[model samples]
Target: SAVISQKPSRDICQRGTSLTIQCQVDSQVTMMFWYRQQPGQSLTLIATANQGSEATYESGFVIDKFPISRPNLTFSTLTVSNMSPEDSSIYLCSVTGTGEWEQYFGPGTRLTVT
Candidate 1:
């Protein structure tokens, strides 16, 4: 199993600003994903970050709004651009090993845009 941690466990930001959350994995991972969970909603996948390639954003999520970066196999970043109150959600970083089907998630970054 891989251990994952996210920076800025929680934060409060003003509307229209942006926040960048970082995810670090103790071991190299084959797959990394970014997800958002609203106040009363299920987890929604934002994008899949692959090493040395562009991130693939899910439906309703565009690169301009939720940009992702995978510098290598163990680190990635997700930036919420031009955030609004509606963007306030818990952002989680999930990962799976090279041959594993089980996915592990980080503690998550809680963002509250006011």
Candidate 2:
């Protein structure tokens, strides 16, 4: 099992600004992913962060818009580039559980853009 922590539980930012959220895991995880949950919406996979490689983003997400960095096996960061009010959402860091397809999520960084 892995324990994950995310920075900035909540924040309010102006449009066109950027925010970088950090994710730290207690143990090395085989799979780490970033997700976004908008108001009244289901979670959506933003990207997968694999150590020593560029993050693989899902459809509708580009590296230019959501840059991810995994410096090591237990740590990663996601930066929201060129923010906007439309970007307001909860960014969650999740990791696949040991030997299971289930994922554990962090408390999440809730961002409100205005």
Candidate 3:
């Protein structure tokens, strides 16, 4: 089993700015994912952070916008660049297959871009 730790549980940023959230795991994990939860909406997969390699982003998300880095087994970071009002949402980091089909998620970094 692994535990997820996210920093700056919540924050409010200005438009045209950026915020980088960090994720730390208690144990070494192979699968680490970044997701976004829009206001009053479901979660959207952003990317898969590969250790020692660039993150693989999903459709509609690009590297320049959402840059991710997984330096080692138990650490990763995601940066949301050029923020906008529409970008106000909850950014979450999670690890899958911890138990059965269950995924362990961090408390999430709630970003409110003004």
Q: How many residue pairs clash in each candidate?
A: 0, 0, 0
User: Model 1, range 14-73, lDDT digits (tens) per residue?
Assistant: 988999999999998868999999999999999989899999999999999998989999
What TM-score would each prediction reach against the true structure?
A: 0.96, 0.97, 0.94
- CA lDDT for candidate 2: 0.93
Least well predicted 10-residue stretch by lDDT in candidate 3: 95-104
Can you tell me which runs of candidate 1 are displaced by over 4 Å? Answer: none
Q: lDDT of all the models against the reference?
A: 0.94, 0.93, 0.90
lDDT-wise, the better of 1 and 2 is: 1
Deviation (Å) of 6 in candidate 2: 0.3
Question: Which residue pairs collide in model 2, if any?
Answer: none
Model 1 residue pairs with clashes: none
Which ten-residue region of model 2 has the weakest summed lDDT?
Answer: 98-107
TM-score, ranked from best to worst: 2, 1, 3
Point out the higher-scoring one by TM-score: 1 or 3: 1
RMSD to the native, candidate 2? 0.8
Best by lDDT: 1
Where does candidate 3 clash, by residue pair?
none
